[model samples]
Target: MEQRTHRSEVMLSESFMYDGVIIALIISVANNLYDLGVLDLANEFILILIIWYGIIEHFIRNSNVINFDIRYRLLFYTTLLGGAALNTIVYKTYGISYIPIIIAPMIITLLVDYEFGASAGLILSLSTAFHHHDFFMFLHLFPQVFISTYLLKNTKNRIQVAKAGLISGIVSLVMILLQEPVRHFYFSMRDYIVIFLNPIFSSIAVVGILPYIEITTRIYSNIGLAEIATINHPLLKTLSLHAPGTYQHSLRVAELAEHAAESIGANSVLVRACALYHDIGKIRNPEFFVENLKSPEENPHNTLPPDVSKNIIMKHVTDGIEIARKNRLPIQIELAIPQ
Candidate 1:
């Protein structure tokens, strides 16, 4: 056990080192691309350090709430890097107003939670704003980031995502109007369209790519959970056909668990999804379980010795685990099976 613990510590140190190298590369590339002076580069590095500290602090504080594993770290950095790159490209090509500032925050919020999303938004907004010396752009984007993340909380459908985007766009339009001096400012229709539609377009793009991100990362959003928890899912359908009693029981458990989870401010969608699949192992020998047994006379336990019956019943946990793994369910659902 001591040796295993030491190995785990070494692996963790190596992962942090790897993350540091990636962050250094990102900073160097971004600074050079922007042709930032020494002071600006230093400021950017400081911002990166602050963001890094926040990530570590969040993981430490919320260890029980989230698994801050290598995969999650990768997801965080990938979103940051993607947002930075896109922001740079768009800012240089089109302009600052056209940059999709909400993409990183929205995606992070959907995949993880709003807190991380908010943090990510802060870093991206500050970095971009500082780079361009556009505090006004930062002011415009920062609130939109928070609003978009807030609106996207517990998102269960694509339409909700679009709605969040529309609302964010409206907020952006208001910000634009507020910033400009109405008496002196004259705006073209093109400017109005760009300011009003940027968030909406960015949101539509996020919706289009969200499924691919979920599939690739195996880190699902509530939308993905909603999809998998539907009656049409092959595993759920199989459970319903082969173990109707277990299926019905699962549905009831899901309903109860969902309500309980919601009351506790937990991820009710995820809880419900896990509950629906928790009994899938019983499908292997439906009659062995009392719930699936059509009658008391059909109880397999009565015919078997106590030890054998206990083993059969206990095997469901392992069976459920195997089935969950075979189906490539989310890690949360897979972990819930044994529990």
Candidate 2:
């Protein structure tokens, strides 16, 4: 019952935040269009709002990506709103900007996952097309964005991220050349450089900013996860020293859960991380548990009444919560400690 209530509170909080983001997106888009001198303000705004809500409901909420931590949800909306706003300002000034399609999609893919990133790519591409009334732009941009998101889904390092960006750039270059083969024949070095360097530079920026984003948002990239999984982590080392049996149990559970998650097509990173830290509370009273008992005579629970033993065993869960909170563990890891 407690767990259910906690889950309900989390859901409600997320729902409220979700609604707020949706409102922000609407306001940002509507203001952009207004600044661009959109005619028929009432009808156009209403139509756009309806369409935006439908897309978000279908692609975000229904797809289950909205259930991610609130920080990630905020990231997604910020990327979308900021990208749209930038695209609008650039289009009003120059003609086009690849910021929305290239850089934004890359970050989303690496931070969130490929599926949500791809969804954002498509939605943003379509929104760009509608905003500019250039359907061809949609055809030109979607493929590159999709390719970047799909390719970078497994990236674990900066080099890999850059490689994915370059690959996506190559795809974009091919699409550009195919659209007008005759124009490239007369194109100067400056034109070629401008077109080709966009993706590469955008990719570099993504890699540079990723660490800052991870720090601020408390979201772990694959690189961040690897860093924590090492024995040198403070909490893990303490667990090994104070509760060796629990440490070994966690290791075995992590190994088995990792394999099972991989076999069933679940997120192995999440499952393994949870398994590794689930019994961290046992460190608080190592000698009280049977798994850590040094001898039959050393079993402390044997001298206690049934009720007292049960309460003592239950205390580990609360102790784990305290430890996890103190260490500032990820919410997923903390949640798994009880189970």
Candidate 3:
């Protein structure tokens, strides 16, 4: 199974590279006016870097956790490189530019992870300082972008992202005061609003849409945690009311299986899942199970010989599997049922 998963990843890489390049190319060329003399050169370099790192790097060396849909990777590759490309175009065509400014970090944050985004933002912010020779403003934005993006790392929901943004805005206020000349080129009083709002809106945007993204991908970002919790889900509420003994047994087995997983370095998720529904078979004959008997009800095999009674008990395992399958439980849960 591991080998099968590996092959799937490898195949995906091979098929996706061409698409990544095309995405980079399209985004890079868009609104990028080549007629600009000095800015044109800068744009080319930035575009190349985005492609080399975002798309090519992933293609040549697969990341442990980070990845792109072959085609989508293309879009991201160009978007970043293209931001530089577009920046150059704007500067050359009309001299209105935020290429190396606002758009750069957004590109980095969307395509790469947070740390990478911060580094990219810091680099660009520093480059601006070099171009205009203002070390103070350069220093201010560099650390601010790093701190803001870093705080935003691993953000799964909008509320948390917004919190980070809020914190960032607060920090920006401090940075502004510390910078001395309150009348500097920045927004002054408005700087406070921008600093706080940038993160708030950005975090909100990501948080608002993350669920739909997860659903479309069918990717279990935290499948292990969620899967284990589901075994005891309220659907089992019905099971508890109807087969209380079975519920208790399943719970105990799940606990034991968790211990076994620690002992063997096995897939703990699968073990926990197996333990949860191992005795779904008992649901078929609740009366036969001791816990479900309202009143010391007579055993069906009370008059049978020991060997005959044992066979009846054994039949429940097979019976449980049918129930699990009938309900369309996950394969891991279904397979974990008693043999």
> Which model scores highest in TM-score?
1
lDDT of 3 at 336: 53
lDDT of 1 by residue, 272-334 (tens): 999999988998988888887778998979889999999999998999999987888876677
Q: Note the residue pairs that clash in candidate 3.
A: 16-70, 20-74, 23-74, 24-78, 281-320
Error (Å) of candidate 1 at residue 201 is 1.3
Q: Which ten residues in a row have the lowest lDDT in candidate 3?
A: 216-225
User: How would the candidate models be sorted by lDDT, starting from the highest?
Assistant: 1, 2, 3
- Per residue, candidate 3 scores C-alpha lDDT tens digits across 269-294 of 55666777777777777877677676
Better of 1 and 3 by lDDT: 1
Candidate 2 collision pairs: none
Clash pairs for candidate 1: none
TM-score of every model versus the real structure: 0.86, 0.80, 0.46
Off by over 4 Å in 1: 1-28, 34-39, 54-56, 63-65, 68-70, 182-187, 303-307
The digit string of per-residue lDDT tens for model 2 on 1-339 reads 999999987787577556645644564454357355444334334544565555554555544445656777788777766666665665566544334366777777777767667766766666666655566667767887888788787665678877877887787677667766543345556645655666778788888887777666656666556556666789999999998888888899989998998899876777787888888899888888877877789898778999999988999999998898788776567767887
Worst 10 residues of 1 by lDDT: 60-69
Higher TM-score: candidate 1 or 2? 1
* Candidate 2 global CA lDDT score: 0.70
**Model 2: how far is 275 from its true place, Å?**
1.0
- How much does candidate 1 score in TM-score? 0.86
